[model samples]
Target: MHIQLLGGFRLDCGPGPVHVVPGARRLLALLALRDSPVPRRVAAALLWPDTTERRAGACLRSSLWRLVKPETPLIVVTEDALVLGAEVDVDFRRACAFAAAPGASPEAVTMLKADLLPGWWQPWVEAERDWWHQARLRALEVLSDRFRVSGDRHHAYQAALAAVQTDPLRESAHRTLVELHLADGNPAQAVRQYQSYRTRLRAELGLEPSSHIHELVRPLLR
Candidate 1:
């Protein structure tokens, strides 16, 4: 059983997809992202945040009734908690593990390159999505630096470019790209990237790039 929650919500039972309503999908997604047994009260509260506890609890029960099956158990219910089925796996969890490594294979970047449950603006979902974004950004920065140190300029540039594309305002990402261009004997490209960042920063935030990043491209600017 596989649950995909990185780019979007999907469920694969074995050979085909399982159809579920939007309410059920949200419940399952919340539990899957939590990656642990959520206390019944806590689950109810989060799912129906604006309602009274009693009403939310009732809503939780209705959703659970539609979800729980006798033969195909998708959730394991304990005394006070709701647990994801033991055999179920979440793609976001796997993506996080992949993003945790600095020197991962190039293909693994695909797993790190997705927004968590895109289009969902719930507080919990937004928090997790932001967390994943920052984590992937760190992973990309490290991967770029590692490739740069190893003299793999092509891969280094790719990673740095991806980082900048992922978050255009990230100073470290711009710095990485500048360094990569300089390493590839293109001071002109380095200066171009630095100038682009400087212009963007000034336009968006009324600020300049940090001294650390400015120093990286200062020689070329002169």
Candidate 2:
């Protein structure tokens, strides 16, 4: 069985995709992400923090029960904890491992491109989502740098631009894009990129670009 948490939540049990309710999906995702047994109380509280503890526990029980079937069980329920079945494979774990490596294959890069569980508003999900976003942005930056050094300028530019798009306010990504432009003998484009970052930074945070960033584009300005 394969479970996908990036882009969205999905479960494939070989025959086809398994249908899961939203609460159950979230439960399975949380378990898959933890990749270890989680205390039932803790899982319930994290998933339904707004509800009373008893109600949250009841909700968790219902979700866990829904994951059980005569043919296959997706979750393992213990006296005090819950965990994904041993047979399950989670995509987020694989993507994170690949992203942290020195260089990623094209397929790995494609996997990293997805946003984690898009549209989920739970606090835990949101935090994990932010983590994945930053992870992918960093991975893209690494990929861009590697491509630039290896004389693959076109792919380098695309990767850098992807990092910028992932987090427009991230100065490092913008810097990478600028560096790529400068390397390609496009000083004008580098200046344009810096100016755009400066404008957005000032508008969004009422702040100026750092001196470090200014230094990067100063030569182009002259």
The candidate scoring highest on TM-score is 1
State TM-scores per candidate: 0.88, 0.86
lDDT by residue for model 1 over 137-161, one digit each (tens)?
9988888878778877887788878
For candidate 1, list the clashing residue pairs, or say none.
none
TM-score for candidate 2? 0.86
Candidate 2 Cα errors over 4 Å, as ranges: 68-72
Write one digit per residue (lDDT tens) for candidate 2, span 1-222: 889888888888877898988788889889988867999999999989999999999999898777746355678889999988887889998888878884734666677778888888888888888888888988988888888888888877777787777789999879888887888789999999999999999999999998878999997688
Q: lDDT for each of the candidates?
A: 0.84, 0.84
Clashes of 2: 0
